[model samples]
Target: MKTVISLLFIFMVIVGCNSTKNVVTTDTVSKISDTVKIANEELEYEVIIIDPGFSSWIAGRALPRGYYSEAYLENKNQFYVAEWNNRVAQPMQYDSNLYLFRIDYDLTIRYGYEVNYLIYNYFIYFQNRYNQRLGGFVPKQ
Candidate 1:
């Protein structure tokens, strides 16, 4: 009887601990999602503010095959996040889920000026590195 009582107490304690841990984990995940959403919104707003015609250009473009890999885009995005923070004087976070690569792919396809891969990368690298200032100056075709 004593053994049964001790076992029951231990089980209850374990279950209680697990439930609390789960709650904490869930809360953390929710907060993270919220932060991501806000950051994505801010990113979108900044991009539009800097390049008002970008959306229209993107709508008319198609993504090219082998033009960019997921891994490469992700690395660029991470670098962009760091550069953006330096430009904006705030730590702007980013996630791969933000669809930045998709936007880039579309923009690459819609680029009006004749450009090869090398020229295109230089243009985009400067645009992003400068937080769209270079992009705004470049006349879109």
Candidate 2:
């Protein structure tokens, strides 16, 4: 059986800005459908991330692939996933649109490098794009 983990981000333009000051203009948003699929056939696991500017952000703003080890990425992903799930559980406290679904990340299973890399960068893109922090460390390119 295939364990497909889909983390869907509902895209919406926020008119007003708050403390974060990460203003997303119309030009900044990608016109094309930015759908990224991270799959490991051996593990029978797949992760689909659907967000507007994620493809462009990953190509231009994300750090190089070799910059961080798989272990590091996995660790960061664990923390990010935890915070993401927390927000998903509380719709009233957090934005229901943004935190629509909880990410199913199993720490025991080794999802390989590609899966971890994309997941980690997606978290970074998510935090910077949405002006929300999931972990203690600052989200950087």
Candidate 3:
């Protein structure tokens, strides 16, 4: 009877320990994933901002600024031309804003570092990969 009681006590302690470890492990994983997501998002935002085509037009021109406070979808194309209307200039000139635009957006990655690589690399990889797998920029036919 004494041996039986001791064995059951040991088993109960082991079971409790396992449950605690699992809970801690799950929390840690959730935290890491959240961090990676934030980092990836920031990387995307940087790519969109530094892009020469859009950066040029964004500067010196009085226009409505798009959402710059957060990560936005990046256009896969390295070079892009978007239509912009400037009525202030005599006989409004329609200019193109260059940068790949994103049609869909994910709000998860607002800040942090991703496991794959530096956040910026994600943007660079995206641009390079898209260009490699698909055809490059060309004016509409």
The best candidate in terms of lDDT: 2
Q: Model 1 reaches what TM-score against the true structure?
A: 0.30
Worst 10 residues of 3 by lDDT: 9-18
Q: lDDT for each of the candidates?
A: 0.28, 0.66, 0.23
Which model is ahead, 1 or 3, in terms of lDDT? 1
Candidate 1: Cα lDDT at 59: 33
Q: After superposing candidate 2, which stretches have Cα over 4 Å from the reference? A: 1-33
Please write out the lDDT profile of model 2 over residues 1-141, one tens digit for every residue: 111122344422112222232221222122346776654433445566777678888899989889999889989888888898899899999877678776777766666676678778878887877788876977577
Candidate 1 lDDT over residue span 1-141, tens digit each: 432232221100001111111111111111121011111221121111112222233334424435666445444444543443344343254322211221222221221121122223433533543345421343232
Score every model by TM-score. Answer: 0.30, 0.75, 0.18
Give candidate 1's error at residue 5 in angstroms.
Answer: 68
By lDDT, the better pick of 1 and 2 is: 2
Residue pairs in steric clash, candidate 3?
A: 37-109, 38-111, 39-111, 39-112, 75-100, 75-101, 82-97
RMSD in Å for all candidates:
21.8, 13.5, 24.1
Q: Find the 10 residues in a row with the least total lDDT in model 1.
A: 9-18
